[model samples]
Target: MLIPAVAARLDPGWASRVAAARRKLWLALFHPRTVLEAFRGETPGFRPHRPFWGMRGGVSAVFVERLLTLLTALPSVRINPVGRLRHMASGPRGTVLLDFAAPPGGAPQRLSLPAATCALGLGAEELFRAAGVDYAPQRLSVAFGWAEVAEADLRHCPFSLLLAAPGAPALRVSAGPVAEGGRRVMALEFGHVPEGLPHPGAAEARRALEETGLLREGAPMRLLGVTSLPCLQVPSFDNRRAFQAALAAFHARGPEGWAGQLLCGAGRLGFDSMNEQILTGLRIGEP
Candidate 1:
């Protein structure tokens, strides 16, 4: 199914987060039940609330819920929550998900995600579909992994290896290459982020992006897909081998239960620096 790009400010407080309704645009396009089931699974005895417009609303609710339920209950996926998520997106930023950060000089190896957790994560299509009319491609802000690496690093970095074939996009802490794509520039990430790259703050890079007109002024940063980017594809490794390698790495040291499952990323790849042409007056101006 097609998805949308969504930029939202997450409320950390449990109550506050729960109280906030799903994006209105999404609710308008699809049935609310689909949203609920994706998270809540089977909500037994879920009766439809009769809106002012009576029967029709009720029927609509039922239809939506059933469809969602089928989607949820069927043999769906056994993704490594984070890896699978990053694997499915279509953006450089969305692909570069940050997992737990390594302490200074700490040797880091693999990533792990649990089975149950708030699925704030999604794929590229879902992000776009969620955007609908609400998508304002300004500042792409996502969960920023645990530590906020400079956007400069993210842009040049890859999520995993020199080449992430399937699992995740390669993001390096240091500089990487940006390829020329027809009329667009495709940034290719490879290896780990260089330690010299700015840590907590990347305002300088942010400004540079704005100056270049890649990121606009008031847009809410969006987290495109799961943040825990894993190395699923070894350019030379066969698909089966890559899949096995990714799975084994996680299964051995997976995060405990729900705490591990939430994988997502918000870092962005500036508009291929094609403002004058592609982005020229696309107008949804800043947030």
Candidate 2:
């Protein structure tokens, strides 16, 4: 499952700092208390200290709404109301942590939503509890924690695969040359992979990760389904339409980039809310 979330960039070269902040926020949300509440089925909220990089492209209320609209169009992964922290998770149990920046950043931050976009995710456990429902596992997690995928690893990697481990499984993908010498590496696909991938030992590596707890387990186990997708973009310019079209083509399945980018040229770009008309359009999940 891939969750595509977008935000604005404060500096052109703040990849490390930016990645740190993302990690912090994710950590804050994935706590024992929050995880517990989530299992019972409730929507939780979080607001970590804004990282040093300022705010990425998507943060304003309007952007969030537009994102919400995109959410509406998608399936399951709906935009839930932001509330106080409910349940979160306790981890180190293996969650695929990643952060990317575009060309400038040179690392994780560079791999972020080129256009203003990101993702709002809710796992299975959270879903059940939020809807006042029960699940067969009879178990669930409250929140997801922060993780860091090595920049070198993600550099040539295609996309991230999210799975509710202990059940779902690890995301099987190609390793290209990243894992060549059995170096316990991370993958960073500059943007999208060419073709005929599924790296030679990708499946084997995935199985190992599934059991090791890096690719699976931890928070996703209870959260329910997962979300992971491209929040990619090309370059920004006056002729934005041209840029959008090209980037859109790059937005494909399996470790690629985002289909769309947001037009963030306002004060400290933030998120938008698309509850009404915007909030009724899509589908996405662990794929």
User: Cα-based RMSD of the predictions, in order?
Assistant: 23.9, 23.4
Among the numbered candidates, top lDDT falls to: 2
Candidate 1 regions off by >4 Å?
A: 1-192, 195-200, 214-232, 237-287
For candidate 1, lDDT tens digit of each residue in 31-120?
556656745876434457543432332234555566557767767633222222222111232222234324455543234322343233
Candidate 1, position 220, lDDT: 31
Per-residue alpha-carbon lDDT of model 2 for 40-119, expressed as tens digits? Answer: 88764445644333124222454666766986898777433343213222113222112322334333231122222434
TM-score of 1: 0.18
Ten-residue segment with the worst summed lDDT in candidate 2? 264-273
Off by over 4 Å in 2: 1-202, 214-287
